[model samples]
Target: MKLLIVNPNISTSVTELIEAEARRSASPGTALTLRTAPFGVAYIETRAEAAIGAYATLVELAEHHAGHDAAVIAAFGDPGLAAAREMLPIPVVGLTESALMSAAQLGGRIGIVAISRRIRAWYRETVDACGMHSRLASIRCLDEPLADIGSVQRDKGEQLVALCRAAVREDGADVLIIAGAPLAGLARQVAERIPVPIVDGVSCAVRQAELLAGLAPRRASEGSYAAPPTKACQGLPPALARLVGREGHDNENEEGNS
Candidate 1:
């Protein structure tokens, strides 16, 4: 199966991190194509950056989704995930929700570890959106600013381990989820140190994407997820405009696809 993994942030280093983890986890037959956002913040730590990520994600998929069976938005926050699902016919997976769901299967209470405190509220909102809020044990983060966005895992490894341990000790988290794109592969690196099962967002997302695409589920026809009606989507990119106008389709397969 062919998959497209889009890193919503503009940082190529973070994109490389995601790509490495994905390569380590993906099956041999699974063809992978990864892309970094041409627009948006270097990394998404705030709600405003996340919004730009959402827009960039939509534009990326709209232009490059052809021939790909599934897509994974590499950011832990999953910006543009829902909109992509609504707009495109292919199954799209987000890192945060994938990690949360994987943690749920591993144990009872889920603990989330991120690099920044600024992301706590937004990550909480994501948990709530995924309906995993009730199962959340706690969220732990390091408040100090980082010198670089690319090497966060290498720089904060010890602190992150401590945070994970505290979540297990203080918050009673039976499972831990290492959140954020930069820390994509940390779970495997430090799994022995943590007592509970730890989930890596990128790994779980890639597996889930394969599972969904393997099923080959049809696009939504009715309900909120069904495609929007064609309208004059002016000033959008050419590919997006064509989708919005339902060009080359017989009766608007994109009424739910667009």
Candidate 2:
């Protein structure tokens, strides 16, 4: 199976982090392709950025490789998830939704440890959309910048684990989710220290993507994602154009028709 994991941001570092986690989580025999938007707002720290990230995600999907069997949006906010699902025939899985679903299945109530306060609404909206709001205990913000989570020296790792424990004990959460791609590696570390299961969105997303793609027997339906736009896209990466089959003039024509 070929799965495309998309990080809807300009940061290649964030994309690499998600790709590494997906590779670790994906089942054997599965091919994981990681891609990121060539032009998008960085950090995605505010609500505006998250909203823009949604559109950026669609742009990424529109230009996705034609050979991929499935797509995973590697964002905790789950930006452009519904739109992408509607635009693509193959399975489109969102990290936040998949992680929350898995977390809910593990326990009666789940708590989400979000990356920033601005994304609390995104978390709430995800639960509401999934009809799991009743099962959601609380959404806690780490109150840290997104970039800080990726720093090895920031001590955010230890702080995140402590927050997870508090959510389980004080927030009455039976399950916890570390809800960000940058914080992907923290879940297993936190889970070891906490009593409740700690879910990582990246791992959960990859697993769900594998399961959904595996269940589908039709390989012909693969790679039917929205075609790339026709207009000239500045700074469009060469790798992206090669994967999607069109660049420059041809790309604009496809996008115009799509």
> What TM-score, over all chains together, does every model reach?
0.95, 0.81
- Candidate with top TM-score is 1
What TM-score would you give candidate 1 relative to the actual structure?
0.95
Candidate 2 structure quality by residue, lDDT tens digits, 73-180: 988878888777644546789888899889878999999886678878867977788888998888887775545445632456677677777888888999998887
Candidate 2, position 204, lDDT: 92
- What lDDT tens digits, residue by residue, belong to model 1 across residues 166-197? 99999999999999998988999999999999
Give the lowest summed-lDDT range of ten residues in model 1.
249-258
Identify the runs in model 2 with alpha carbons over 4 angstroms from their true place: 144-149, 152-154, 217-258
> Candidate 1 regions off by >4 Å?
245-258
Q: What is the lDDT of candidate 1?
A: 0.89
* lDDT, residue 147, candidate 1: 88
Task: Assess the local accuracy of residue 207 in candidate 2 as a C-alpha lDDT between 0 and 100.
Answer: 89
Candidates' C-alpha lDDT? 0.89, 0.74
